[model samples]
Target: MPSKKSARLAALTVAAVCSAASTVVLTAPAHADSVRIHDIQGSTRISPYAGKQVTDVAGIVTGVRTYGSSRGFWIQDPQADDSPLTSEAIFVYTNSTPKGVAVGDAVTVSGTVQEYVPGGANTGNQSITEITKPTFTVVSSGNAVPAAKVIDAKSVPAVYSPQGDTAAGGSVNGLTLEPTKYALDYYESLEGENVQVADTRVVGATDPYSELWVTVKPWEHRNRRGGTVYGSYDSQNTGRIQIQSLGKTADFPVANVGDVLEGATSGPLDYNQFGGYTLVANRIGTLKSSGLQRETTQKQSRGELAVATYNVENLDPSDATFAEHASAIVNNLQSPDIVSLEEIQDNNGATNDGTTAADQTVQKLIDAIVAAGGPTYDWRSIDPVDKADGGEPGGNIRQVFLFNPQRVSFTDRAGGDATTAAGVTKVGGKAALTVSPGRIDPANAAFANSRKPLAGEFVFRGKTVFVIANHLNSKGGDQGLTAQFQPPARSSEVQRHAQVTALHAFVKDILDTQKNADVIALGDINDFEFSDTVKILEGDGALWSAIKSLPKSERYSYVYQGNAQTLDQILISPSIRRSCDFEYDSVHVNAEFNDQISDHDPQVLRFRP
Candidate 1:
């Protein structure tokens, strides 16, 4: 789903008729008394009166939104209706800031009913019922607003959504909503109506866009650090709701995970493109900080080797996060012997000037680590072709290995370049890489427009170890959990599955040559631990993800839309896992904090070879 601001900008550019003040006349006008708000809403996800004009729909103004491209006011009918399946309120889009509408004003609006789908229909998002090109007259002033319907843990069903009808192309748009059976249906039933959630926990921190996420059910899949864990696809945390403010952006609270929104947070329930259902709040609650602190992992012993993986989130030479990232590596991670860094952008980041070198970027980070009282690290990586890899254009993001020479030594072999393929061979009856810091099958179709895996050889205490670093294809084009298609399609997984298959075969080549060889593959896998991508990488017992060794509640290294999930992982071979003497920790430092240097938390693995 797209962000609300981006969706609004798209609307402003594409839909010109929405900005007109004249009445938009549709096919035929309906009788004033026959077309109630509920009658227009019907009992389905789409409005029954869409693309038709309705006259004199009476309601009281519940909230007024004067910001963004989609400026509108919500009107709710005070008169009660018996059915709980239809909404009593509707948004009257005024195109610009509404002039004479107040929160307590009673108005009768006459306009064309439109089903506005944010981010367009191809995104599979549920459409929002709105009365566009509206003309309204105030009937009364200073009237009481309708009572807000409370939404809590008991009201939301455990089941996330219903299976879409096969006849309708796997869309639940035409089916009648069952508010009691499914959580998505329950939210659809209250669309455009005034709602409230009391004393909720902040699961996602306040992002740069001034929006945060909260969960009504505080205890559902709650982690030790007060986050809702998304263990699997079947267990979607249905209590999550995105919150945006109608007030000024400066007035929005700055909150971290585990904080509390004390008192009543009341607003009109809206469906947007970013997160499925959102609360466009007129009255936000007071923030109570929980004092959630960053976590630090125990340092590795003299006999043990510590290796870590961290995605710096597109680090460049000009980024201000260098010092903070250095502190995180030295203090929080306890200075791992070998670190696999992902998204290390070129020196001229995102400039598209055909520059493909990242020596300046890497050297700046090494300097920062030394300034932070850490080891003097040596680095090795192959520069990618300009604009060939995916990510910000001209960034040429690739994986790099940073090793502390005092504790470990890198074996450098020549003849590795951007387009060459690395192979495995045997040296002294031990598995060895032909070209150290060489790419694995760089020209394969599976790695097209994506980062290729980098393989390196390291020696720790006279023991040889093979490390493969990867940043797989991202989950950019997949459908959301609240998509109209039930069991939403993961189209992005096709390329990821192919990439992991190639990776699995490469790992097998080494293990087949030497059955007991020690290998550690780590980085941002960009898929869940239980996903097919991970399973393919672990094919035929060639490797195993170390994240599964920890308890279920402590497996996540990323927080997305209030669901604590896993996108980064470290996998070990039979030589490491079979010994059963390794420790894995997903350090929780950045993902849960408001002042974050990166969106992903680092993962550390410690073991003696």
Candidate 2:
């Protein structure tokens, strides 16, 4: 499954789309005699016999998954089909736990052919051809399962997906499958069949759900940290496949990035709602740890002020990772002078009981930091209206500032609240906030159900530094990279674009007031550095994202579905970047490890104001 942070809105969107698409029903024709599994699967993404009934489909059960809500068995025909584009196996969608079904049993199934779309039809994910409402009889026992298809680097094509047909609204559903030409088509060709991958590198760590992602093509977009770097839209890593176990969760191997799944990992290829293509393994391989250690950034010099941004994945007081997070801050981060924390939940967390205060949550983290041999850090934040800011319900997630009082002083001007907009004012020929610890534009529609940027003024060595912390709208409900539509539509970027536009205007207001003002805007923008959202925020040269100053290989702060990319950032004004003396680091503490306190890697920026 996807991370819990973004799954709420994504689940709602998927349900709505699937509900509308399921309304269309076609009357079934007379049941035809003895159809091959490949014949039912057809040569396209959609089955030719969809909505029609087929009888006496003979195959051997290769996998029986009795666990989970969608329990079913996968059957594959031993007889070879001439067309490589059509799959020889298919999943029988039994609504409940399958009874009296085991692997290697020869059976004949009768059912209606259907195309089930994973993650809903609106997501543009390719549909899985399956048999629904199936009635099967075991013909024989202890039959050998078909040979597992090997999916190594050579078997998968370099091409990610074919160009969708323009006539069909940029969808490849109507196009014939070319397994040898495209990677998506190659995987679709072997859907529901047993497949094997040998010694694949773990690109994504084993998450809470006992699922991880691996790359068959190890060299594709590989970063120095053994992650597949998603540099651009054109280079979608086609070899990546999500792994889940059909066995007990305890038996599943825990892994991290750069680790290896030793030996042969064999499983049935299936499509699911969370990840598009998944391998439900009946046989798991041993986990070979790579000893990937957490990275530590150099401590800032006396003249430098270190600022950091970390999204603590909906942190609450009840969470047990507070100690580990505190240790990361003290040891790995070296205790930055000012830290911008995003997704800090309310006192009661996700209870949804109209609670909005996050005092307990913030205090717990501060206490843990102090216990971990860190300086006593003070904080400032404005509480949002209960459930007004989009996040876990009742959590009331918001941006917060934690500063070391011994190093820097916070300028706290009164009258800042959740609704009041913060503006720039010239105080004695210098730029200053009208209301410190205030929001950028709380009333703006761009931030209607999203977090508003919090602007605060800080004094470090007699210099005024304006800092804006933001947690913009998430990228939920967006089409995936392997979607049926070519160059899948990023619908979630619409709000992010608007959000960054408003943020840019606020930064411009500060720069317009005082041209040489030292401004540092940092937090989880929830978009990529190369994305239009970042470009909009950097428009008119008002700000520049500090992550860009590093080498291309070292710019990522988040990893999703085996793709290492940027979601957290720190942008600076002309005064900070003109000197060209800042040090930026995307600390590799959380995103690359199996044991993680957060999903995002914290970013640090050190410079003299």
Candidate 3:
């Protein structure tokens, strides 16, 4: 588990990596007796000896999934096998290269059993993956799985994704989400893992590359599955996996609407979304999406704009998501003209319909905003996702800025310093892929999952204030959290330091050119006054935190256990620092996102000349 500090720093982020290979291949899972595995992680403590290399360990083929040439199948451990925590059938995978396999086909799998800490984001797939040692292969003469009717987590059901059908039917089995297991750990890993799952009704195949999502126990594992999200963080990762399946029953061979899925084992991938660590999977399947809906047409009057940040804690936008969450986000902090939000996910639009549950929806957030009845914020903006965006395979996570556009002009095609679309696309110019940080090069290198600062020039006051939105490195404090300039900390600390250093450089560059420039560095910096990165930035004349000059209670934006500390921040440049009357308003560092959309609340800085 990541430390409290790390989780807060980069609640959202990704870095670019060096090079990734296209190697993805796996023979099949060897079906043997029902072997039981227990206390998985505890047992597999990496030792100096034992089966030194990859071996053939087979169990019952619980699941199978195919993605391009990359394929995977899950082998169930009887829950009593004495093995490393890793060996206990959580999730496993091949190299980035593709493989050949189909659903329900049991065969022998020969791969190395690794004993080490998985160095990446947690998506419930493999805490670790093994390089195949190539063992013998065998096919099962067993029966085939029955046709599944793809269900969702809602009370009602639909035929395909709300967007309608395609060459690859967007049908899928469902999953119930939970806060503990999935949301915290497993949920993060779903971005891109070639999972070997049994009994999923292959919904939509857009082209030669098919699209699919895995399912767990539908309806019961919402946090574990369901919503569309991406988790890859950098060059080290390249895929996204959705809960086409989560919790399923053993007896229910015939999947019905809202039926839970069982018999599933997944493989980790080399390519992943953003994580302090990298996801290494051969191939990733596309999860269906209800897509995004941006409404920029409403008229607006500009005056006082209130910018706030809320955790929205695991908001699904589904019919049952907090049912009471609507009011919490409405905000008492000045009728919000532009509010930055976190943790809201995509559920199928129109919860009012007689649908059992939602698969993925773009309107979910919009509906939540409306449910708040700002009555004042009738005008808004949202990114309408298409068949792409991979339907948020890592669960609902993405920092969103809600403004009138009347208030803030969005740089539609603004992002990335990568090859094309700037940093938007990953995996060889895939038009609609998530972007990791590390754009305009800096002296400090930026890798995947290290949250990069998002910059935008916002016209505030008569002049433009350079806005650099940031969610630093989270998860065990960036593995890089040591005293960059100390000894013996995970390299994660190094990653975060690099991230902050790059951010500082970027801000410095912006300031160098603009004589009277005002740069506001906001959002979970994840560091404090004494932290290495913060010290470096402060040393630079870059900026200072608004909370630095506030009362103790007002200094904190998040509370861990019982200790209140300031994680979210509002840093301003020298010029901007002395330009306004700033007050730090702390809402609820003690509250969860039922009303609190995220783990960190907004640090309100009321600055007026």
Candidate 4:
């Protein structure tokens, strides 16, 4: 039952240096020689003079931050370099409060130039060039601030990364930067320098920490809902940048996708551990309306029963996403007759109280749907052994069902519990669940610490339909693409394959019992539709992936980095597929927007019962 505010906030400390309004004056020394900031911060990622001692580097103190582990101040030369690829500012890492320096004080510092990686050097992350062990003498105070360079949509490059291995193969921590064509290079060129973007559009939803993301190149690589599509390798969209209030006079305004920044966004460009190339703003424009509205689909006809599956992302009663989720189910999804829900948490959420029941949570969602002008839906699920189901500790995330009693009726039977496996049998020439709302082979070793599939029986318009809701093992332990291994092993799929095999066998058993039985298995499968895990799920054509019926470009239900991928699906039996009456819709309410309540979007299937 974790809330949407679960994303960790970036931590920062208050500055102990001079205020932005400080003004003082002093005379410069009689020395005529000095080192330039651009020479210390070269055109490349690494400084040319790194690990060497330098004397008398002069600049105006633009910022002084004396409050953190890497305590430092930023200084910029009033006379900037002619090349756009070279930056004029460099950070002087004091590691403590320096005695005679403050913002607006033009000074000369003597120190050793070094490149420090925020994390470890082996983490494949970029490094920051800094001046450390510094002694400085103030020459003058309250000098005029250097004019900030303006960076707008036209100045940004369309390419996301440099070509080939020369740019570290598009790695986030790459060492090479091609400022002419790469987005990463464009941002790196202005590190620690103040810049501005005008008439921009907010792409991501504002987070609990009051930060958001915006796109300067709004039309390029745009998705249907106005988000810049993020893709891997050469197709990556390099337009989006994170907005923070670190250098701002006020906090960033809460914004949704398509909202405009009417005045302009001006700030210092920074790179950090959480996300790269963030624009830390001190002043932002007023938010203007984009007139964006929530979408709703057409309701199902008399002959068709609409079924949907949604992963609510660890929902609990305390979560505020329930109302928006209910609106999605009612308006966006058109009130599907039966819905499969994943990640339903226990009543106390992550309190670890040993309680396994989710009645309060399920009731809250049902009430929300009813309040949103949908039917009064009934729910069915078996509580798992305390903490046995994998999720947030003590939360016991599991799958459950919400069925509209006015359109469908649950077939209740006997002999089913958390550990007892459900079986199929023939009843009046149709397949029937031996135990209504039962677990499918709950004792099987393949489902250890994972959500055991919840099977149920239902009748719509005098026709029987069987469904098994599932939330399989995630892609947690797999090695990333940038791992030490060349083709990073997806070992997490071994367990998912085993889980899919069990599910495939269950569908085969039911089809063997009655050849014409209508069966569907749907939820977050945690693998691509064309992946080996899905290949095993469709073993020998036992069940076909209904999502393949969609166009190749439209088959996605989730977007990661910039690639449109599918991690949720609905697979159906041959009997249901042969009729050709099934219609599928990967509703686009959630995945494309930053204001989305869930990370995964819901998929709907409509067919004659």
How does each model score on TM-score? Answer: 0.95, 0.94, 0.41, 0.77
Candidate scoring better on TM-score of 1 and 3: 1
Instruction: List candidate 3 stretches off by more than 4 Å.
Output: 1-305, 313-326, 343-363, 375-393, 405-447, 477-491, 589-597
Per-candidate Cα lDDT values, in order, are 0.90, 0.88, 0.37, 0.76
lDDT for each residue of candidate 4 in 30-65, tens digit (9 for 90 to 100): 332346888867777667776676776878777665
Instruction: Please count the clashing residue pairs in each candidate, in the order shown.
Output: 0, 0, 137, 5
Q: Worst 10-residue stretch by lDDT in candidate 1? A: 7-16
Off by over 4 Å in 4: 1-57, 60-73, 77-86, 91-125, 130-139, 144-157, 162-175, 230-234, 247-250, 319-328, 371-373, 412-436, 440-450, 473-517, 525-580, 586-601
lDDT by residue (tens digit), candidate 1, 88-191: 99999988888777898877777878888777777777788888877776766799999999999999999999999999889888889999999999999999
What order do candidates take by lDDT, descending?
A: 1, 2, 4, 3
Which ten contiguous residues of candidate 3 have the minimum total lDDT?
229-238
Better of 2 and 3 by lDDT: 2
Cα-based lDDT at residue 514, candidate 2:
95
Candidate 4 lands at a TM-score of: 0.77
Best-performing candidate as measured by lDDT: 1
Model 4 clashing-pair count: 5
Model 4 scores a C-alpha lDDT of 0.76
The residue-by-residue lDDT of candidate 3 on 1-609, one tens digit each, is 233345335332211121222221223234222222222222311211212332334333444434332234444333334221233343334433224433343334444433322333222212233323333133442533322211223211211112211332311101221212222123222212233443332111111111122333222212211221111111101112222232222211221111223344334322222222222222223322332121111122243334455555445644465423445445444335455554444453323222222224324544655667643242222322222111234342334455545354433433343222112222232121132222323222453533334444444444444555555565353322101111213334566677777677666665665545666667666655445756565556777866677643235555332123466677777875676645555554222211223456565555542
